[model samples]
Target: MTSAPADSVDALIEAEFDKLDLNHDGRLDWADYEILIDRYRKTAGVNEDDRRIQELRAFYQLHWLELLRHSGAAGDSLSRNEFVEATRRTTGDTNRLDAAKVGGHVIFDLVDADGDGSISRDELGRYLQGVWQIDQSDPRYDFDALDTNKDGVISRDEFVTGIQEVLHA
Candidate 1:
């Protein structure tokens, strides 16, 4: 397979960073991520004790810590450049493809609402609409593309592989 252009990978990284920034402040902080988790929980009707909810929270926390560790910043926030650098370090790759894969996995875990190791169309649509603010008209979140196996559901591997393909194309 042909590798994606560097510009494409950079754009994907930037888009993912912008989506997580939430406040349009060009930085990611606890407050922004907290809002994200809370919003998803409320929209998805996930209870506090739900294992998926807990896992989401835990994973987000772990990712944040990893970012901070890589950035070596004293502040609780990560600028876009810092975020990119951290992702690169975390993925241990000079190319951004691995970072995109890691981000895709994180996104898969977040959107898989039922903790069943796959994402239903409903779960993906809800996440797109509620969290990513993408309307149904936006083909970016279409189930056909995400459900790479034509199974009507998106497994974690499918989701990550699909994302990688998109980013690398």
Candidate 2:
């Protein structure tokens, strides 16, 4: 796939970071993430199992921390500039490619809730809701593109490779 221009990619990442900031606070901190998690937990309904909620909480926590660490601001929040810089770093060089691949795997594992080595539409939807604050009414990614084989499920290969393609494109 042809890579997108670096400027475009950077702008895209920046826009995404703005979306995740949630509170219009111009930065993303632990509290902002917690607010999102809480909203999702509530949206999941009281009937949702505690175990599942806990698992999602853990995943979101790690996801938040990982993003912070990538920005080299683990103990603090990230401004848009910091986030965009970190993302740009991951799009360059062999070491960056390796890091990006590992990060992609981590995300795939998180979303594959049943641990069946693939992500179903339902799982992806739920993950988007809980982690990214993306409601069922709004998908965060192109589900069709990620499915790759039109199989209605995203295998680990698809998730990782699709992520790489997205990053470079």
Candidate 3:
């Protein structure tokens, strides 16, 4: 359970801006800015059904508007670092929202690859690969950590509750 970096938001923002400034130009045209935001929506599950980019655009329209308003009349675009900080800060505190945490359900769904309401070690390995970007070949791929009770399977409760202790606080 690695802690999110102290500067996760900053890094996210910076990376986006750097990516948008493809030509190393200080300014971003509409196409350039949209490209960056498009990536964010897809990765964030704003558009997971392969729907049109407009669907993703609608998801971010209000949030981007809010961010712009928060910026107090920005320049050509939100700076790279600012975008990440905004995302991190805007995410609701998981501890405060117990209604199945914003992403906990998504993570659970991801782990339950077969839609079987629970996960086995193999399913977990694939989930970690797809969602958390973990490599199964990594030396630290300890299957036992998630297989609480040593039953050789990861019940939803075990995977969620066990990982939270180290990851949440």
Candidate 4:
């Protein structure tokens, strides 16, 4: 896809860096990343374990490379327009109802454990694993872990909270 102007991408990248640069140092560093992660997970009320933290770091590395290669000049950060485009590609577009419909379908499919038109815990755990690209030779343990009430099915609220917890965690 054709990208935004160089200045545009630079602006976007700077904004992202500012947002992620919690220390307000005008640059991103590992120390800033730790603060970001802790705050993000705390807001989501989730705790990311070490493995997931590593995974997130790897993903960010890939993202940084992509932005730098596509929309950034050497040693140049991304502009806001370019950053928005890049993020949209990674997170899917929010401007279209069709996209939202598809997103819901994905979540719904993940939660339909019995294929009976309703979401259950088993389906939910699998969905989270899939969303996070987690490897599961058998099945996910999220259902067992988050199903505090031990009900046969996890409510919609539980499903959302569980995924958010794991994602930020």
User: Which pairs of residues collide in candidate 1?
Assistant: none
> What C-alpha lDDT, on a 0 to 100 scale, does residue 4 get in candidate 2?
77
lDDT at residue 72 of model 2 (Cα atoms): 85
Regions more than 4 Å wrong, model 3: 1-100, 137-141
**lDDT, ranked from best to worst:** 1, 2, 3, 4
Q: Tell me the tens digit of each residue's lDDT in model 4 across 1-169.
A: 3445656645644555666656665554456656755543443234576444444444455545554554444454544455555544433323322222333443443345455755665455455454333343334345555555677776655555554433222
Q: Point out where model 4 deviates above 4 Å.
A: 50-54, 61-169
Index of the highest-lDDT prediction: 1
Residue 85 error, candidate 2, Å: 2.7
Runs in model 1 lying further than 4 Å from the true structure: 93-118, 163-169
Instruction: Give the C-alpha lDDT of model 2.
Output: 0.71
On a 0 to 100 scale, what is the lDDT of residue 24 in model 2? 81
Regions more than 4 Å wrong, model 2:
22-24, 29-77, 93-97, 135-140
The 10 consecutive residues of candidate 1 with the worst lDDT sum are 91-100
lDDT of 2 by residue, 1-169 (tens): 6777889888878877876787888988878766765655564553245555565566557656556657887558888888887666645544423544665775665577677999998987887766675665554386777898999999999998987776666
Q: Report the lDDT of model 1 for residue 37.
A: 84
Q: Write the per-residue lDDT of candidate 1 for residues 80-132, one digit (tens) a residue.
A: 88887776565554242354466677667668777798899888888888877
Error of 2 at 87 (Å): 2.1
Clashes of 3: 6
